[model samples]
Target chain A: MELGQKIENGMEGRTGIRNEMQMSFDAISENEAFARLAVSAFVMPLNPTVEEISDIKTAVSEAVTNAIIHGYDEEYRQENDRETKKVQLHCRIEKDMLYIQVKDTGKGIEDIAKAMEPLFTTRPELERSGMGFAFMEAFMDRLEVVSEPGCGTVVLMEKRLRMAEEADEL
Target chain B: MENNYSENFKVIDNYLMVRMPEEVDHHKSGYISRTADDYIMKEGVGNVVFDFEDTRFMDSSGIGIIIGRYKKISYFGGKVFAINTDTRIKRTLMICGLHKVIEIME
Candidate 1:
């Protein structure tokens, strides 16, 4: 099943998506850098400013890291199926707006609202700063989280580049 | 100010100086924390200063690293300082209300 078609969202109806991509990888800490760097490269065509690129990269890092650390519980190994738990990185670029969705099929969030609260971490003993969702909300123009217990979680984020707005003015 | 560099770690003026990596994320947090703690426990540094001069990107994991180190030393009357933070790092710290907790040297 394609992750893009898994859920219905209000954003799917929007047209003019210039580009789109979906990738699935094993849920592992090492892939965090791979995920964010790939996203930075994907958005390069938008000619984002250094600050904008940093913002996008940082947001992507938080979402993917959460999926790995919280979702699969560090090392993902299924006792029955032994299938590798996967984290899906999906992106859509429409005009100047970038849409991102990081999905994971693992132990889903029990309470998303409480999870989003700043400094409210479920794993403080791990020295988690409890700022993952907070930073995502700060860096992205819009952030939405949908999760179900014993199923999975998808973090949806959107950002509009200033360069794109300047182009619209011309 | 003896530059005794040991694996991205240094000690200056009794402060443990941790030179942050280029990209600080969850993958690297564990290692960073373990090494910094060694200094706090073994070397007995008075304070901790995180150097972000080479860091171009940092996620909440960076915040965790800093906060974890701060907690380790604070009970012993140690202070945590962050130096060379770029706009992104600064904003990350500010968003989490970390500026109030740690001294940020811009």
Candidate 2:
């Protein structure tokens, strides 16, 4: 099945969301960086200002870095046995709202709730502040995490750019 | 990619001075934080002054690192100060409420 088909199958039954786009790439830090920029560009034509753009970029970077550094661990693993793992990102923009899903078929998070806690990290050796989810939550309107042991992990985030009152409050 | 670090000690006391480069971002923040941590331990610096004469960009992560350092040195009765600033970093400092704690040099 195509990558999009796989993601759709994985995300099925959760919500009847549409206008989704899926992008997949081999597990590389550079790829993760590029994915962030691509997602930003994809959302830019919607007319977000430079500050909004920076917030989105920072959130996307945290998400992508988490995928590469925690989800995959391919970079630190032995390169000789490197199996090309992939990080798939699915984005949907509808009705002035943006929903993003980033999934990785590598090591699933041990405790989803704990991982979301601010300043809590399982990979301190890698200098991860465990603040990825916190930043995502701070930047976006909603954040959801779904994972299964030995299966994979998916992070879903939603944000609305048109909420002027909400923006002022934030 | 461009940064300068100097380890200078006072002639009569045990204080270390770190002039953090003007531009601090995700890439250089960690390095500067680590260097400051190590320098404090090695030089037994009582007070740390971070001369932000040329700093342009700093986010929450940078603030976190600074806060971590402040807590680390507080046991020794040492304090941290930020010297100089631009509008951008100043706004970040204000948002993070560091101005209430750290002394900002004029």
Candidate 3:
């Protein structure tokens, strides 16, 4: 699965990382589907159920879409003609828990609190539901957003996998 | 997008039936929205029925696609229906509180 020509990849571990992978790709809408699909494949070793796989994929989709749509200001990018925008996805698997980090170096969020509000979209003309963060929170066990104006945004999400036998509990 | 996705739109009994793609996301939302809205405007489609049988993965962008169409048609008393929704899709609808606006059918 390819998403926006992977620019860089690396592996780093701090807390006894079982497996970790990181890749950076162009921040274009074309990557949203492939990005999530790649993460879904990365977590397959956990033996996630259909529901769990869906959950992880949806969360990744939301994060990557946010990075492309909101992080890189469409108007500014269009004016500058510098479409080399990039999004970084880093995933680590330790035990049954999956940790995901999606980062972008585009214009950061001005008000993180208001941006996370359900149904509050900055680009209403585009028909955005403003449910990106909300959906990420619902699907993942933990979600954290850190951003600064003009610097960029980073979304951190973690999900604990349940084997097939335990999938029914969810 | 290159394969004339508008073919997926069909008007039956005044209801616009949309055969969603395999993966609905931001990349495809523009096409879905443009094609569906055209039917709603030109063919005068009343209600909208979104068939998710082909959709293996969908994010919140799918919600936007549904709601954008709902907003355009609901003013004329048109309703939106989601059919063939699975467990994950149902959970997403429930999470976003979309049941209040759109009807989910088995």
How many residue pairs of model 2 clash at the backbone? 1
Better of 1 and 3 by TM-score: 3
Model 1: lDDT equals 0.86
The list of candidate 1 runs beyond 4 A from truth reads A1-17, A74-82, B1-6
lDDT of candidate 2 vs native?
0.66
| Colliding pairs, model 3 | none
The order by descending lDDT is 3, 1, 2
Give a tens-digit lDDT track for model 1, residues B1-106: 1233356898877898899888898888888898889888888898999999999889999999989988888898999999999877888888878899899987
Interface RMSD of 1: 0.6
lDDT of 3 by residue, B1-106 (tens): 4466767888998999999899988889988998889889999988999999988888999999998999999999999999999877777878888899999986
Q: Model 1, A1-170: lDDT tens per residue?
A: 45566432323333333889999988878899999999989887666888889989999999999998888774334541436588999998987899999998878899999999999998898899999998899889999999998788999999998875564455
Worst 10 residues of 2 chain A by lDDT: A10-19
lDDT of 3 at B89: 77
DockQ of each: 0.81, 0.13, 0.87
Candidate 2: residue pairs that collide:
B22-B54
- What residue runs in model 2 are displaced by over 4 Å at the alpha carbon? A1-21, A25-33, A74-80, A125-127, A163-170, B1-30, B42-44, B47-64, B81-106
Error of 3 at B100 (Å): 1.5
Candidates sorted by DockQ, best first: 3, 1, 2
lDDT (Cα atoms) of all candidates against the true structure: 0.86, 0.66, 0.86
